[model samples]
Target: RDNADNTYTESGTRKRMGRKGIGKLAALSVAERVKVISVRDGDKSGCILSLNISNKNADGKYEIPAIPDDQINFLKIDETKSGSAIIMENSRYSINKTIDSAKRNISLIFPFACQTFKIHLENLTTGATATIDDTTMDIVKLSDALLTFSDEDSEYNEYLNALHGAFDNGRYYRVLQEKLPPDQLPAQKVLHKALTTIKEKMLLVTITGEQKAFDLSICGWIATFASSSDKKRNTDFPVNHISIIANDKLGQFDILPDISTDRMGEAYVVGQFFVDLLEETELPDIAASNRQGYKEDDPRFEKTLELIRKNALRPILELKADATKEKNYIRDLEKANKAKESKEAFDRSIREVVEHPDFKKVIHDSQPVKQALETAWELKDTLKDTYKKIMISHSSDDKPVIDELERVLHFCGFEKEEILYSSSNYYESGFEAYTDIYDYLKNFFVNTTRKTDLCVIYILNQGFVEKWDPVLEAGAGWVLNSTWYPMYTDTFSSVRRPFPGTAYTPKLNFDMDEKQSRTLAGAIYRISQHAGKLEQTEETIFQFIKTTRLYHG
Candidate 1:
């Protein structure tokens, strides 16, 4: 097809999908004997095509075999006026493979078959027949996600309806609804939110050293499956293929290898793109040998590849990610809640074992009682002081800094009722609501008559230095000699140098570095250890400080 001498093209209203006239020779490679029959205006002609060209007539042309005209007429219907048919005898192609394979191969190669042009395959030995038409996309009907784009209004609308019907009232939605918790958004809403917008992409690509630019437009549908195995697809035919079609003819069976990012999601993806401009008559031929595919360096082909990668493939994967994150979040939350409830019940039963009637006689010698007593002692050693009330002293302006500290405390196994902050709603129902603010502080901090142990954490910042209430709380901690620590939010340089208002100098590290992370972890570990609420190792808290969004710049 590349050489001028062998290139033969036909003129028609539609662009020709073929250039070279060597398709007849392909039959010789698949079959031993090939019969070609033609009927034009009721005139019949027949020939026996062969790979051996030595049997030629005196005119130096291949010899034609004589056959009866009636034999060719019976192969066609009475209404047919003009058509050609090739019947290969003793075929070598279909012998090794099953009938279904032949059907799938035909479908794979010629995906543009529609109502006007259809292909039918039949197995004479088994009576199995398959027809290819507009329903070629039905193979991907069970896919978990689908994305369709086309410039043509009719085709785009058709595929859009199919997408909505699949997600809104189809198998994926039903499964998610049955599995997910009722409080979360429905699967249909999540998918619809992700796929809310679609846009058509085009690029103007020009040949090298040429001023004329060609417009390349890519259009098609892409599908992704949760599972792509042959058994799941219910067919041995490989369905994870993205075909390229130009002028209603196969250009390449798959272009995914050229455009894929090698992500796992790529294995589940399949689609076809129609780029008619690749076969434009006015442009130089860009197709590879035998129309297998386009030359990779061709500008039009490169732009088409870019369009498919950026527009079509990306959106489908994002939709899958959104749906997966939502489903996993709900499931993980439910599991964590269940684990918390079970841990509480287990702890209560462990406490009851200590109150057993025969506990004292067997506690010293029996293995089971020794184990139970050790467990109870370890639990008491770690969490006995967790009953102490924690007071977080801070200004209202430093709410974000205090909130991060609250989260760290919760992570250390402190409950909502055990920790008190002025801004938190957990303390609103206590006696502090009705009593005077100054009187409540005196009663909470310097009230030696009270039985509860108290620990105060001073939030040292510019706001803390400027406000009266935080300074008063700090003075109370200093006077009562309560266990207290000063945690700085703003850098020490931003506040008074040498720290004027407090008894101890605040640490001068707020930048995100190894030293700062270690300092913060050490402070939190000491607080949790003093309250007997330490649950995680020191290294775990260090890693949390280094990775958390609150500390990252």
Candidate 2:
């Protein structure tokens, strides 16, 4: 099976054999869109066939309707050969396929395919692979191998095409449905229409796994898919079986969407679908949960279940309109004659805080200070929230260590915007290479985390303890260190690691009061932990933060 040297007339014991169906399935099991081609031995020509399944057609009813000649960009399939020789270009045919940081990952899963074809997956952002075997891989054979006749989603698209109603769309749902932004996803009508269909016509959907890393345009597709469809007596689309099977619950394993014996299967299917996507995707998990209020079989949520049942579309719209009107009325009243008095009261508060000796010293750094001030002002200007954002305190010498720390935060579900990077463009003057150190402290008075949450600190070897003025100043400041601050090693924030002949020393130095990773993770797990729910300034600026003293030892 390793080589194809025996594919000729056998004089004594030589023989030829064809490829197995298992290989065909392996080729088809790819994550996204896959096209196959083939050319068998002794054939003069070959053909091209593209067989693909997408989250767009999770209901399993759609197929390649034939690409219009004008829309064809980079493919020219020849249908004249028979010995099987196919070419796959991992280019623009897909975005997730274009290589980036996860190159080593893709190759590990498809090693045989990679080695056989001598294809190398390069950068995670834009790289690809090519495979060549003794057997020809032409388009027609490849397509045939991937194609599976499925009629399950026959009414999928049609039912989805008409889901407008009183709960999902509400009164304005129809009007807004017609007014989707020009750059939005396709089949707006169908997707919205499926919202209230009682026949259970939707199925064959995909979540694509990387929903956490894509653009809003793509995420919108998943939102629409999850929203508009009415729960059918027939089914709830399972989250498993997609190219990306990261969904933690509800596949073909435990229950079928159509099982008549279990009435609550629908709840399990939908709730688990959400839990799976919430694992890493960037969707609004809280809002989605709040609206539907469904989760792992909790009886206490009976009221939530009632809301889900009564939901049609119009009532939701009514509620949204009422909320918006109430917000506007409050704003208008504030803008009237009462505005001048309120402004004086507000300005007095600012002066009282700024003029206080305690605040004056807590604020005012040469680098992070300026940016913090600006961010604070913006937060105050838009007083919708009480606190503005989460501020991180770090010294310039600890850039590399802090950089790595940032990566960890993002890895564990924290957003960069949620945690202010003191090294960003906060100061615009003599502090060009060095942003103002005092900006953040000035902003602290307005709303510490209105624009963000969960402030963190990165410590480095001899950086802070060795009398680094910036770190020392920050540690003693009021606004920067106001509340819960989880500290990390300099390497967590720094970009550099052990240089040429060094001892590979990576250590962070700070207080000795820090707790375990789990303890800190619970206290400051992510930015969302404190967003739209509470103010960041709840903790005193003078509160003592638990930290760990570090050394090369």
Candidate 3:
């Protein structure tokens, strides 16, 4: 069960055909009549191995037959980008079996791929994940728990860091209270420290066995709500969602004393508090150490409002006439201050592009100048440095042109590696193909393990009318912008589709110079230089495509 291998192997023990762990060892023997209808992608790469078994075969040894070429399935190939997607299939998996395994093989295997589970379990029989009832399930406690957790897993380590930050924040929010608990400060700090280490875009999470075990109720909800949807049932199992839906579900949030556009970031910070809380539910004992973390200030601030409820404010204000206008003005001033602070924080977070002195020579007066400066200062922290990257923009129909361009880049000193093409080697259609492309691209965007420094797009007159090309080009431009700003008109929304009867839709620019690789490479190079990241050689960026794809240098 290596992290890199998405497949499962017999680990602890092996057993006879009728016993427990046998299925994990290898495919079982099956009748000669076993058919091989299956799912595959159009790609000639990224293949996975699958085995099938039946109860009838008398010999224990696998008398396996090769899957025919006709039985093999392929994923859709995107003509516009390099990525992967989720592959769906129609099959006769019994209720006891998963799509990927038979009913009897579940504990050793599963319905979907083994990669979906955090740790091996008897889920094959249980229908629900086993739940544990430790206090570590509390977000605050888990933040505390992370102190003992080292960075063995970068993703989990980051989760621990965010928890430290959350506790720190709890203390800061306590300042407004009159009798704030003394422990509130450190509890908040602990969580805050844990939060700072998370990568920005990761969405999926898996809990190992020793990690927090949720309640059967929670597990049911996670399976139905978080896991794959049930197409035939048109619904998944449900659980008690009421507890998870409370207004102060995690904790309190405060308006930053005033309302200002600048304070918007504060509001965001306030809202994100909930996310960090839920993420750390794995470690419960930390709460025992954090005795003062969940303390609250007295609620006596309601006393000031009691006067108004009792109709005393009008009379008091009348008696103190001069203070009325002053109080009103002060309230307005507070709002203005909050807005300023919010914007300042937001700017600080999104602005981190590196702008060495050389950037001015490329993108003079770029708006992300402050970001560039910060990037320059943090130059030592970058993963790689000074690698050349070339971006290609072209049409799919001009595959030959791209290939020639790539050949030229190779000749010009670009390696056959490090290139990211968005135009030629992607899925055009098919379930398996779609999944393959989606996975690759999503990981590139969300995981720390995979990211592209340069972007290339192919534009053809006929290709411009389709949706994928412009969608990818916008994505590339966005990456170069370094600010990760979403486009309204220019970008194709992944969440929403184009509406029917709409009066307008964006038309992609259909024309481009066929041999402009050098110019395009220069622009991409500029982006790499600004980020102070490893630069890809223009030749390397172009060569891989030359071997098979149409887009070249």
lDDT of 3 by residue, 1-553 (tens): 2132322235523111121223222222222133323433443223222354433347666544455555444344352444443222333332433432332232212111123233332343655443222111232321211221224343334433433443323322344233444543222221221222211232223333453322210110000111112112211211111111111122212212211122111111111111222223322211112221222221111221231112222222221222222223335346646855775575465453323456456566565875666564464244332222444444455555455544434333344333444443422211233446444443333322222444333332434446574555446444544222111212343213222212222212212232433344443344444333343554443332332233332
Native-to-model Cα distance after best TM-score fit, residue 167 in candidate 1, in Å = 5.6
lDDT of 2 by residue, 1-553 (tens): 2123433235633222221223443334443334443434433332233354332366776544343433333233343433333444343323443343234333322222212345444443443543332111111111101111112343223212221122232323344345555454222222121222212211212233332232110000011112123222122223211111122111112212222111211221221111122222222222122221223343212222232223322222223223233334334334543745765687799868866887767766555875787675666775432222445566666665455445434333343444566664333111224445455344443444323333434344435545554454355433443443434453344323221212322233333233333233343333335543222221210021211122111
Candidate 3: C-alpha RMSD to true structure equals: 30.3
Q: Tell me the whole-model lDDT of each prediction, alpha carbons only.
A: 0.63, 0.33, 0.31
Q: How does each model score on TM-score?
A: 0.56, 0.29, 0.18
Order of candidate numbers by TM-score, starting with the best: 1, 2, 3
Best by lDDT: 1
> Model 1 RMSD to the real structure?
12.8
Residue 372 displacement in candidate 2 (angstroms): 24
> On a 0 to 100 scale, what is the lDDT of residue 414 in model 3?
42
Residue-wise C-alpha lDDT for candidate 1, range 92-174, written one tens digit per residue: 65453556666666666677666777887777777777777754545445565666665445344555445445543244556
Q: Give the CA lDDT, 0 to 100, for residue 316 in model 3.
A: 21
